[model samples]
Target chain A: MEQLKKAIRERGKVLSDEVLKVDTFLNHQVDTHLMAEVGKEFALRFKEDGITKVLTIESSGIAPSFMAATDLGVPLIFARKKKSLTLTDNLLVSQVYSFTKQQTNDISVSKDFLTEDDRVLIIDDFLANGQAAFGLIDIVKQAGAHVSGIGIVIEKSFQPGRVKLDEQGYRVESLARLHSLEDGKVTFLDETVSVQS
Target chain B: MEQLKKAIRERGKVLSDEVLKVDTFLNHQVDTHLMAEVGKEFALRFKEDGITKVLTIESSGIAPSFMAATDLGVPLIFARKKKSLTLTDNLLVSQVYSFTKQQTNDISVSKDFLTEDDRVLIIDDFLANGQAAFGLIDIVKQAGAHVSGIGIVIEKSFQPGRVKLDEQGYRVESLARLHSLEDGKVTFLDETVSVQS
Candidate 1:
């Protein structure tokens, strides 16, 4: 977790007050070493839970989810952003709105992948508005599978994402939590202070 | 490699004479263990190339590239299918036509990721018509990076992908080569026979 915070400070670029670009290492171009550590952190957090599969959205979520799924020794299922010729009607579909793209996309997973017997851990690159995570959770429920926990790489705590997930009674764990990105300076939430507070 | 061949024979679904779906373990719902083996196989193949980075397209290519980059102890960079808010004018873009999707899409990689000093190994899930690989190779050339080798999980030998790359003088290594997918049955090229022939 400390390593993640350090990477954010050293390499993360603040484009605007509302947008923080860690594309240098996190999303566009990935640091597989740091990603392995992030996966280990998630695996350690949810080691006791009987996670059958790791679920994520397309594009950004695949790397972290791939690492976590590999570390956890479970298969990973990522929802597709666009419907392909291979993806048939046997799917659990959910609509997600992306503020960055300002477009709503339908995300779906094959019904053959998830079942009631499976326990899923949802992982993603970032948690901003929580729309993507919420959409994944909705698909998991539609498959009759159990949501074991949610693992996030970076979270914007000042946003309502964490609070919304908390209200939904889902256990959420993030490697790095951003308190603010005000005045082109990124501030991370101090775990000790937050725990005490 | 034998494991991949066996997986293909068992779980691979032949939807038609031209379409073979391995989504059960390769793309949509991924088996991380198999993917790790794939990464190790690629690492072994290109162990001496001094690859500074691994490159691929978004979505399906991320998993295999993640594994290969981790094993090689390098960073992984994937080209975005569409330009996002984070991606600015600093990019090397290429247009790719997807035969399956029946549309052409622009793929771009951030200029910050690749450089002239970098030696890159390109990895992808499948090698069909080689349009995606050609696009990636073009981007790598645009950035003045050297292409060490190209790694593919499955190569449809009946298709022109392998031959086109061969004509272009790019070294390509595929884990499994499909001889034919006829009558709803997939047949892999026999390594010994092909080498002898």
Candidate 2:
């Protein structure tokens, strides 16, 4: 978590409107070492939950999900942004609107992958607006799977992501929480958590 | 490679138009343990290439790229399917047409992540038409980066992927190259590879 926070401080670029570009480590270009640390934190946070699978949206969330799923020794199901020829006809589909892209996208997982017997841990890179996480949770719920927990690497608490999920009764844990990005300066919720920098 | 090959044979379903769906392991639903094996194999294969970064297209390619990049201790940069707010004006863009989606998508990478001094190895989950790989190579070339090699987990040799890349003088390596899928029986070009089932 310290490594991630350090990476965020050093490599993260605070754009206008609370957009933090961490292409150097988190989303576009992944830092496997920091991700491992984040994965360990997620596992520690949800070790007793008996997570059956790790669910995430396409692209950005796949890396952290990979590390967490591996640590939990569970399969990670990523909802594809576009429906490929490979996906099954029987699926749990949810519509998610990405404010970043300014478009509505359908995210889905096969009905065969998630079942009532399964408990899912949803993971992602950033929790902004909580649209992607909610979409994944919808898919899990469609299959009658229990939402064991939601793990995030970096969360923008100033946004309504955490508040929204909390209202939905989902336990959310984020390693790094940003309080504000006013005037291009990143202020952490808990600066003491900045151990690696 | 054996594990991937087994996953392809066991869980991989052959559709009407030569689509091999291995959603259970490599793509939609990822097996983290199997992905670790894939990462290890890619590390062994490209260890001598002095790869500074691992590149791939978005979605399915992100998972294998994570495994390979983590094992190699390198940065993994995936060309996004579309431009998001996180993307900057400084980018290297390439046009890729997906036959499955029946649409042409532009793949772009931020210029800051890749440099002329960087040695890149492109990794992807499948190699069918080679359009996406070509797009990734074009982006890398546009950034003046050197593509050390191309690593694919599965190659449908029944297609023109290898031929096009071979003509382009790129080093393309596939862990499992399919020879045929006649009568629903999937056969590999290499004997050392065995299906898990």
Candidate 3:
């Protein structure tokens, strides 16, 4: 977690006061070594949850989720953002709004993948508005699966995402929590605040 | 490789004469253990090449590429299929036609990620027309980077992808090459046939 905060400070770019672009290491071009460490952090946090599966959205979340799933020794199911030719109709669908893209898209997972017997851990790269995570939780609930916990690489605590998930009674753990991005600078939540809240 | 072949034979579905869907393990829902093996296979094949970075497209390619990059002990950069707010204009872009979706999409990588000093190995989930790989190669070339080789999880040998890459003088190593998907039965190229040709 300290490594993640350090990476955010050293390599992360602040596009605007609201957007922190971690494409250098977190999303677009990834540091697999850092990702492995992030995965280990998540695995350590959720080791006793009896997680049967790891679920994440396509694209950005796959790498970290794959690493975590590998460490947790469970299968990973990524919810598809687009309905491809190979994706069948028997799927649990949910619409998610992307603040970065400024558009709404449908996300889906096959019914065959998630079942009532499965305990799902939803993972993502960044939690901003919580739309994507909420969408994934909706799909999991639709399949009658239990939501074990949520693991995030980076979170914008200034946003309402964390509070929203907490109000819904979900255990959310993030490696790095950003308190603010003001004047093209990133301010992280203190360790005590991050852990206590 | 044997594990991949066995997974295909057991779980792969022949959607049509041309489309063999292995979403059960290779893509959509991934078997992390098997993917680690696939990664090891790619690492063993290209271990001699000085691979500085592993490149692939987003979504499906992230899982396998992550494993391969982890095994190779390098950074992995995945080209973004769509332009997002976070992706800047300083990029090397190329167009790729997807036979599955029947659409052409622009793929781009940040100029900061790939440099002339970097030696890249492109990895993908499946190869049919070699369009995605070609596009990735184009971007890598645009950045003046050297491509060490290409690794694919599955290749449709009946298609022109393999021959096309061969004609272009790229070293391509696929874990499982399917000779045919005719009659709803999947047939794979023999070990000798796969290695020699």
Model 1 lDDT per residue over B8-73, tens place: 999999998888898999889999989889988998899899999999998888887787899899
Assess the local accuracy of residue B72 in candidate 1 as a C-alpha lDDT between 0 and 100: 93
Chain B only, TM-score of each candidate? 0.96, 0.93, 0.95
Give the Å shift of residue A114 in candidate 1: 0.5
Q: DockQ: which candidate is best?
A: 1
Say which candidate scores most in TM-score: 1
Q: For every model shown, what is its TM-score relative to the native structure?
A: 0.97, 0.94, 0.96
- Each model's fraction of native contacts: 0.92, 0.92, 0.91
Residue lDDT tens for model 3, A25-128:
87999998899899888988999999999999988898888878988999999999988898869999999998878889999999999999999999999998
lDDT of 3 by residue, B74-173 (tens): 9999999998887869989999998888899999999989999999999999889999999999999999999999999999999999999999999999
Highest lDDT model number: 1
**DockQ metric for all predictions:** 0.87, 0.74, 0.85
Model 1 alpha-carbon miss at residue B188, Å: 0.6
Across the candidates, what are chain A's individual TM-scores? 0.96, 0.94, 0.95
Ranking by lDDT: 1, 3, 2
